[model samples]
Target: MTHPFGFNYGGKTHYFVFDSESGSLHNVDYVTFLCVKNRLSIPFEGGEAEDFRALEKEEIDEINAELDQLASQGVLDSPCTVTQKKKRTGEIKALCLHICHDCNLRCRYCFADEGTYRTADKAHMPVEVGLRAVDFLIANSGKRKSLEIDFFGGEPLMNMTTVKAVVEYARSLEASTGKTFSFTMTTNCLLLNEENRKWLNDNMYNVVLSIDGRREIHNAVRKTPSGADAFDVILNNALEFRKIRGDKSYYVRGTFTAKNLDFCNDVLYLNDCGFDQISMEPVVTDLPDLQIKKEHLPVIFKEYEKLAAAYIDRRKNKDTWFNFFHFMYDLEGGPCVVKRLTGCGSGCEYLAVTPRGDIYPCHQFAERKPYKMGNVLQGVSYDRNVSDVFAGNIVTNKPDCTDCPAKYYCSGGCVANNLNFAGDMNKPYDISCAMMRKRFELSLAIAAIEACEG
Candidate 1:
């Protein structure tokens, strides 16, 4: 069976097939096109093809009229029956390997605890498992041009042996297959030392550390296993690691809990610490915490708006670097591709492999067994149900959002957040709704200023 692929171009669906040998194209049905590549076999409903050689002029006009009707109903792109070659689907661009399931620090807010982590075998993935994962990625290099292996964990560095083994194995695979492998790790940064720093720097590994903000705010929540100050050690190591790596690509990921919402200014203080890229993510919640009360929405949004505004002002003075808001500021007028609008490439373009070789949709869903799509042992397969769950289909088609001006920008909020808070991955909550509104308003305001200046 020929695999089918389709994309929206010039406001119409253009279909093609994967010519594995010659990189040539073939025409096929939209469903067949997607099915051949083991993707969702859905067909586009509207739009006219540039050429209608297969049908009479009257038939072509009829199809074009149907396309026009669908376009009127807000569906503009219709699939075309065309023979064209495109990229294969088996290519592995990103491999998120779960090296360890055991984290040292028990933060007040962690999603892993909501699910059973004890029943999971191999608390830390053995070197052999990592090798197998890397091997699968290497074997599928034809579809992928470049490969990236991200080290994730309860705390990944907790099992440094597996990290080293995977890195070495990936390097070996690269050498033999003539494929490129890039490595990155997300850690609490407590395990970083001179030896590890030197190794990571030498290997050009990208590192992301979890830091809430300044000392008082950071330590108040992000405590060490011993219940002591985790801030000093983590901060000190991050500072030293930047010096050792001699690059600004290293990132600091801050998780905003209700306790630290008032301390947005402390988040900006990282500028004084010499860190460049910083990511601010709201606390992942299954339900509203006492701190994230409904009354707090206005306060939180105002605080976030203030912080974002101040960060933009600082960038004007070239005094500090704030990555989250900076990105929004930068993308003011550019034509946004659909994939880019999704913000994250989670289930659509990426998957996460657990320590035990269990495959889930993405890192956020790794802890939930019900969300586990497949495993590495038997190879991975696509799951339409899982895809729909992640696509925000649960909350997206809601009546409330249908008329919202910022619907496109909000993307119906995060699936994980909805699932966690409402106990249904498809439900929308007040927090995300409010946050989305605030963010959209701020983004539009910024865009307006840019337009006026231009």
Candidate 2:
């Protein structure tokens, strides 16, 4: 069906219609949207002229003409939405390796159960496991000439020896496989010493350094295993890494908790700390200490407003380089959205493998049972979550999404977030939905304002 989403700007209503089947976007006015939407309710072919009898004849004709144009562009809803076939591309392309199920820090809001998978003992992924994961990535990479594997963990740096060995081993297979590999590692920066930093600079394609903004806020949660200072060490490592490899190939990633809704300050904190690339995403958890409550939502919106203004000021000075801008405005077209049909490529195009060689759809599901797609040795075997999520069928297939206009844009939200908050992978929490809607609305407004003013 042609999904129509309505929003207001400059005291006028506008609609953004998307055809899920064709992956096309239609920009139209409120009247056109309503008329077409109304017309599509039945098997009617045109808007009723009697509805606009109050207007002058010429105005009625003008509106009718616009309605015709929208219909021609196929923004009008299909007469039979229920009977349409779903577009499914459950291709596997990317792989994430849980290099180790161990970490050094004891962060307050850690979601991975302190990286031990909620168990007492923590194990570092062996080099052979890494090598096998690399082989699995290449084997399942399909026709894609380049394959990517992310070294993830409680902290990947804890198993630096295995990481180094894997890189060399992956390279050794490139000649025979004819597939090039790109590597990324996410580290908490505790073990990011000068030696490790220099080696990673030359070997790794990209690095994700995780830290919270501002020292006090960071220290409240992220701390070393011995309960000592972690913020200072992480900051120093980031600075040193930037000096060697620069910020383009890396991002200083941070998270926002309920305590810090005014996260604009954190963005500025990172900018002032000589970081050109930074990403501060909202933490996804149900913990009261970290959750952004309904009351906190307004402040977070305001923070984005403050951040957008600062971003504009920076842009005027030729310093605007924000990451989420891509979400605000897309110069190129977006991917085919199939939320009514499936979730992300958890079991299909993406796989996250544990140290013991078991594979799940994504990193969040890496060692979790039932969500397990297959083991690295045996390859993918089907389960309901894997089939439903990886097949591109999810919450959009349900009422909460089907009734929401913004579903096309969000593509039914994250499975991990839903499972964490909503207790069902197929159901989405209203909190995340509202946050995304506001963010999308605000981003669109900011993009429009910048385009006009700049």
Candidate 3:
């Protein structure tokens, strides 16, 4: 009973359960649901045993089948070989380089706190630092034949020269080192033009174009330092970039703040604009205006429903698709088989290097000492105590997550998010937890539908 969790939906309260123990998802009718509920409420001793014997044979058989399945899934405290949590067995597989600490656009809901993290003057990462970051990733990638390098920043495109230099140097190392490199760049599209498009098309593995959906939505929050609108420029660059990017190695990444609760149209808007791969995420912040409010949850849910329908419509039409969270789910397990109890590769397999070569656990923790791992030049020589603390942050260490059915799938929530909202890395973000629950419910339903159809 501990692992099989689900929700009732549609008319007459049809019940669906996700059996996490065996990774099985199935539905139970009203009578079966009631029988299971009643039996769990009472101990099967003297009184409960008599009550159970009074039930009809068919009902008892149905209830017994449910119990057997639940027992098989280890829900009834049945003894079984517990799946142990895994540590990183591989080397550094991915690294995010904060190529610049300054951005040209003045996006209102920027989690980077308007580029400088609201602390100091803006600066760009020099070529030397970027090159060292590339080297650091290569050197520390141990035994892993392939590595992913992400060029992140206040605006990665602002330091085009540094990006080009790093890519070229990385490519130069590939032949001799015999390591395959997958390069990605995240940009606001404010700086994209003919030359930049050509360079990205030629060298980059993929470009994440940051545009907040429709023209009005994009202009409302995402703007230039001079208060100029970003919609026109972003659209223009995306069109040109897409022309050379016929293979579709790019994703239109957007953000939806509290203001844009009904943002489903934005996905359709991007689709109409000829962009297929799209990701629209709710803005993660505690700021009043930007944060997703409780009232906005329903609207967001509806929006996701609409987006899912649109995705199905696209598939039917033999057209492109807007890849969203539900699109990532399969009956086998949402995305991938997560061996570790943790949700992400923050401090273990991935490292985030700041402009000055300051190393952090991940991109969100960049410039923050609390999550600092090591500098690029010095390598990821983490402090013993800090390393131990992060190592213990898996689901087994988190009391709340230990009982959660979605623990294996949710990346145990983001460390940076926890530290930001609750002032502690071990603390959880309750808001995001609700969001994850809704997402899991939707994903489970999609998985059920697909399973039935197939």
Q: Worst ten-residue run, lDDT, model 1?
A: 79-88
> Which has the better lDDT: candidate 1, or candidate 2?
2
Task: List residue ranges in candidate 1 displaced over 4 A.
Answer: 1-92, 114-122, 139-142, 175-178, 286-291, 325-329, 332-336, 341-343, 379-401, 404-410, 444-454
lDDT of 3 by residue, 1-454 (tens): 1333333333233456555544556676644544655655633443545565577888778777867877765655344233555445335778888888899888888889777755586778888888888787777788888889899888998888888898889889999998999899999887899999988888888889988889999999988889988799889898889878987588888898987887888878888888877888788977798898777787887777666556655744536655664356765535555444545777777778888888777888777777666676676354445545666666655667655657666756888888777677777787777777677766776556546643
TM-score for candidate 1: 0.71
**Using Cα atoms with residue i matched to residue i, what is each candidate's TM-score against the true structure?**
0.71, 0.80, 0.86
Model 3 bad stretches (over 4 Å): 1-15, 27-57, 60-63, 66-70, 73-86, 332-342, 378-385
Q: Cα lDDT of model 1 overall?
A: 0.62
Most accurate candidate by TM-score = 3
Please give the lDDT score for candidate 2: 0.71
State the lDDT of candidate 1 residue by residue for 1-454, as single tens digits: 1223343322444454433222123344443333333322334334322222234657545545644554454333323222222111334467788888877776666666512254455388888778877876666455565788898877887788988988887787666677888888888888888887777677646788888887887777667667887788888988888787655357778777777777466667776677767776667654445246677787887776676566555555544744563236334344343432343445544668888887676777885778876666765444546655555442235455544444445545665666667666546565778777666555544443334433
Instruction: Give the C-alpha miss distance for residue 76 in model 1, angstroms.
Output: 18
Model 3 earns a TM-score of 0.86
- For model 2, residues 1-454, the per-residue Cα lDDT tens digits are 5655544544554565655443445666655555555545623224444443344657646866876675676554333243323334444567888888889898878788778776566778877777877777776666877778889988888888888998899899989989888889898888899999999899888898887889988998787788887788889998899889954488888888997887789877887787767778787777888888888887887787667667656656545555543235552554434433444556666678888877877888766787876666565343445645555444445567765545656767877777778887667877888877666655554555565556
Q: Which model is ahead, 2 or 3, in terms of TM-score?
A: 3
| Residue pairs that clash (backbone atoms under 3 angstroms), model 2 | 91-349, 92-348, 92-349, 93-349, 341-392, 341-393, 342-392, 342-393
Q: What lDDT is reached at residue 64 by model 3?
A: 74
Compared with the true structure, all predictions reach lDDT values of: 0.62, 0.71, 0.73
